[model samples]
Target: MNECERCVTLTTELQKDFIKKECYDKLFKQYTNLEKHFISLEVDNQLEQESFQRNNSFLQQSIPSFDQLFEINELKAQSQVKDTVIMKLKERIKSLSENLKEEKIKKELDEIETINIELDHRVTKLVTKNEHLKQIYKQLYDSIKSSCIRSKEQCDNLIKQVNIKSAKNSDLNASLQEKALVITALKDTLRKLKGKSEVDEAVTLHPIDPELLKIDVAPLAP
Candidate 1:
């Protein structure tokens, strides 16, 4: 994957880990508190039982020593009061446990909700970044495509220019050939004229003027 995709993947993994950890921590803390409360309740029950047993033992020990019937009735009354106090303590403990459970549940839900909100925010950011990256990639691709088209057009233009130059060269070569043929023909005509002139000179006219010829012949005779 590209850099942007890699980064987004890593970030998503990290967010998942963070959410898991937060949930674990919240659950662990709630469980620990619950355990502690249960332990406390157990200890309270044990202490209440021990106190009841001790009171019973004391009442038993003192019963025979007190012969007065009124004293026995008062001792009975005190035992009833102790039983009532224990019952009230148990009820209070039960109420407190229920409240603690409710509070713990509420807190856990709140934590979950907060985590969800954070996750949503992170997702939004990742989505925005992904879109932005996509745009950038598209732009780059378009630019590259345009550049390729331009390059191809330039190459085609160059080829056209070369073809035009070749055509011009061909025409110039043809014209040069025609000019050379013409020059050759002119040279041949000039050579023929010179040959005719030489022939004419050899045919020198037997003197058109006979006097001119006789002067030359007599001079030689004299």
Candidate 2:
């Protein structure tokens, strides 16, 4: 029994030591987890402070002072208005650009119209010149035709005159030839008659006085 008591006391002491060691281990784990949680919270707080300081520095740079704070609020309202104004300005610029483009297009169209008018005027002038030229050409053609007709008539008249003159000349030549033949025949007949007359005169004078006959015969022979 005394050994059993001693064994029981030893087991109780070992159990208590094991319970203390377990409690120590549980406390150490809790402390380590708590330390880590504290470090994370501290780091989070530092990050938040740094973010706040950065925001405060930005505000200070952007806004000048206490009165500037109110000015900033007013400016914020003005900024909203400015946004509307900027949008309106953009719209106005767009409208102005469109107007300019339209005006330019209209001007170009007017220029084209003017050019067309000038071209039309030129065409009209050319047409008038062409008409004048046509009239001149017609006059020239008519004059040439009349001159040709006159020249042809003159040529016909000249031809007729030449034919008549040729006919007259032929008739005159025929008459001259007939007259020449007649003259030649008359000359021959007169010569024959003269010879016969001379023979008869010699026969008739033969019975006359010989001296008278001799004187007449000598004159006739000469």
Candidate 3:
């Protein structure tokens, strides 16, 4: 009982700083224990009233001050309101942060899309140019190849003509050499006959027939 009444007494420090909710709750819990003990003590009082009646006055004294209880309730209300406000602020900040990140991502994506478009255009132009150059190169290569083949055929024809002309020239030279040898032999035989006739004066010469002396009587080599 004395302990319960001592808790109810206000300290000078509590008067200066004002009691917080935690202190009020602790005091209130102690008060409840004291009340339960008093109820039990009351039952004992009925059994022996004259013995505990003098101690029963401490129950009314042990009740916490009403002002302290009101302050505790006010403090708890203020703390709940502050916590709610802090939660709302945090949610708002998170929302703003998410929005900023999304915007950054969207801007980067736009840049990437633009780059892709430029790259696609460049690639298309390069491919078209490459194909055009390939066609021109093919045509040039074909023309060169055809020209080379034609030139080779012309050279072959010229070589064949030269060979034929060389063969004909060789045959003509051989025929001319045979004719020169026959003419030389005939001149030598005529000279020897002329010398013999001059030495043999006793033999009379016979007259030749006109047909035998004719220009076409004997044919020389053409």
Best by TM-score: 2
Q: How would you encode candidate 2's per-residue C-alpha lDDT over 113-175 as one tens digit per residue?
A: 976997899799999999999999999999999999999898888777777666666666666
Indicate the residue-level lDDT of 204 in model 3: 51
Q: Name the candidate that leads on lDDT.
A: 1
Candidate 1: C-alpha RMSD after superposition: 19.0
- The TM-score of candidate 3 is 0.51
What TM-score would each prediction reach against the true structure? 0.55, 0.56, 0.51
**Better structure of 2 and 3 per TM-score:** 2
* Candidate 2, superposed: residue stretches over 4 Å from native: 1-72, 195-222
Cα shift from native, residue 8, model 2 (Å): 99
Residue 43 C-alpha lDDT in model 3: 52
Lowest lDDT 10-residue stretch of candidate 1: 213-222
Clashes of each: 0, 0, 0
Candidate 2 residue pairs in clash (backbone atoms < 3 Å): none
lDDT, candidate 3, at 63: 63
- Backbone clashes (count) for model 1: 0
Which digits, one per residue and each the tens of the lDDT, describe model 1 over residues 64-180?
454544555665566566566556656665666686678667867986998799799989999999999999999999999999999989888877777766666666666666666
